[model samples]
Target: MRLLVTGANGQLGHAIDAALEAKDAPAAYVDCVVDWVDLPDLDISSASAVDAWFVAHEPYDVVVNCAAFTNVDGCEADFAAAFSANALGPMNLARACATGDAALVHVSTDYVFPGTEPGERLETDVPAPISAYGRSKLAGEGLALAANHRTHVVRTAWLYGEGKNFVRTMLRIGEGRDEVTVVDDQLGNPTSAADLAHEILRIALTDDYGVWHCTNEGICSWADLAEAAYEIAGVNCRVRRCSSADWKRMNPQSADRPAFSALKNGHLESTIGNQMRPWREALEDYLR
Candidate 1:
């Protein structure tokens, strides 16, 4: 199988690379020729550039699109860049895949839903995005599924691993500060990029295609996650909990986020018998 992975330098992309490199998981990626591409080499937002690359490469069995414009506040300010990367980019790849009869695994986010309810969201749940970033991603999801027959949308939340994410930020801040303030009202899973990557690969291995929610099992507030990180790191720091409103009020530039965006991994577990580890367990392993 010939596999093409975009956003090769991102957290999830790096985790996929690590998974492919593991000798113990030879069967996972065996007989697969993978090509990793990003920015300078391939601009997914440009249809012409994307088409040219597809033509040059000829055929690909699978295209895992991890590339996205993830800046929520930035998206509010610059809708063009956000729509180009998050929405149009996936459409280009999906169209290309449709032409080549290839499967598409598009990475999405739980932000697509307006998080007002307290329960975990299912794949069947209606999406009512509130922010520009969420709308862009929702648009991408629709286009991807509609453009390609073999498209799969994987929605995840609260991701961190070996990159600029919450866990790393907390660890870094703990080094210099005696206390950290985090939002206690906003709730979601703290998924490790590695775990999400592994799950993506497993999905790629199958021909079944649809929307799937993949994240570390348990859910918690940002404050809980920060406290867990400090505890695991053995950092002597106090984590002060504040409401999401307070957090945003304190940081005027902070983007609007879902208050309860926890996703239920129903389809993935039902279809593949694969469920992610709990958030705390994944965090412990990641910190170690």
Candidate 2:
């Protein structure tokens, strides 16, 4: 099976590559070739270029799009660039997948939800993105679904692991700051990229096609997440409880952020099954 992975340099993409390189992991990838395409090698923003590459290389089994314009604030600052990469990129790939008869695994975010105070956002929740980044991702979801290709979209959030993420950011800040303040009100699950990669493999290996949510079990606020990071990293920094407004004061948030955007996994729980451990467990393992 020939698989093409976009955004090869990202945290999720890098985790997939790491699993492929592991000796004890699934050998299906041994016979299966994973084409890791980064920028310059492949740019999702160019439709013609994407079409040409797909036609030339012809990904046999699937195209895993791990690429996206992830910076929330940056997206608000430059909506065009965000749409070009997030929305148009998936649009082009979905079209290619449709033409080539290949399955697609598209990564989405919890930000697509309104993040209002409520129960965990079910898969059926209406998407009301608050930020430009969320809007772009929602657009990608629309394009992928509209393409009508045999595709899967996995929505996750608060991701970390071997990459610059919230946890890492907290640990880094703790290195100097005696006290750190994080958002205490906003709630979301902290997903590890490694676990998300494994979940992606579960979907890919089974060829199950649909939208799924694969976040780490349980939920917490940014302040809670920061405290955990400090405890795990053996850092003795005081993490004060604060609101989003506090953090956004200096590092002004680019896009509107979800206040409560936890994703429930009724589908993944019943269908392909979930191997993702609790957020705390995944966090500990990632730190190790």
Candidate 3:
């Protein structure tokens, strides 16, 4: 199987690369040949460009779309660009995959839910996105699934890796500040991109395809995650937990987010029988 990975420079992409490398398995062993692609080399938003690249390259058995416009606040200001990247891009890939008779695996977010309730969300839960970013991703998920019968949608949350993410930001800010305040009301699982990448590869190898929620096995608030990061980094900064409203007042430009968007990986666990590590353990590995 020849696999195509989009957004090769991003966090999850890097993790995928690392995971593949660590496997150290040849195409014969895994029956796979991986091809990485990203912006400048290929613009997923442009349908023509996406088609042309697929035509020029070798036929891929699986296409995992990791590219997306993730800026929550920016999506509000530039809805068209956000929709083009988050929604249309996946549609284009889905069309290409359909034409080539290839399977598609789309990386989605927990933002797809309104997230007002206080419990783990199942794969069967209906989506009612509250923000522009969430709506765009939901559109992408719908298009991708409808465009191809062999499509797998994986919804994840609070992702971090070797890139600019919440953990990295907190560590950076802690370096200069003696005390940092984070929102305690917003709760979700903090996932490791590396772990998610590995799971994506496993899904791609399988014939079964559908929507699944994959994240670290536990949940926490922003303040709790921040405090954990500082603790792991051996930083001496004091962490102050604040309500969502207080956080908004402090950072007026902050974007609206779900209060409780944690997801349950019941489908994935049942299908693969591979348990995801706890969020705290993943965080420790990432920090180290």
Top model number, lDDT: 1
Model 1 agreement with the true structure over 70-186: per-residue lDDT tens digits: 878899899899999999999999999999999999999999999999899999999999889999999999999999989999999889976788889988888998888889988
After superposition, the stretches of candidate 2 with alpha carbons farther than 4 Å from their true spots are: 23-27
Instruction: Give each model a TM-score.
Output: 0.97, 0.95, 0.96
Residues 158-220 of candidate 3 have per-residue lDDT tens digits of 999978799999999999999998889899999999899888877776778789999999889
List the global CA lDDT of all models: 0.91, 0.85, 0.89
With candidate 2 superimposed using the best TM-score fit, by how many Å does residue 7's alpha carbon deviate from the native? 0.2
Compared with the true structure, the alpha-carbon lDDT of candidate 3 equals 0.89
Flag regions of model 1 displaced more than 4 Å.
24-28
In the range 1-288, model 2's lDDT, one tens digit per residue, is: 899999989999998887766675566677787788979889988999989898788466878899998988899999999999999998888888888888888999999998986889878778999889999999998898788458888899988866778888888889998998778989999998988887787687666677788899998998899999889989999988977777677576446688999989867888867777899998888887
TM-score of 3: 0.96
Per-model tally of clashing residue pairs: 0, 1, 0
The predictions' CA RMSDs to the true structure, in order, are 1.2, 1.6, 1.6
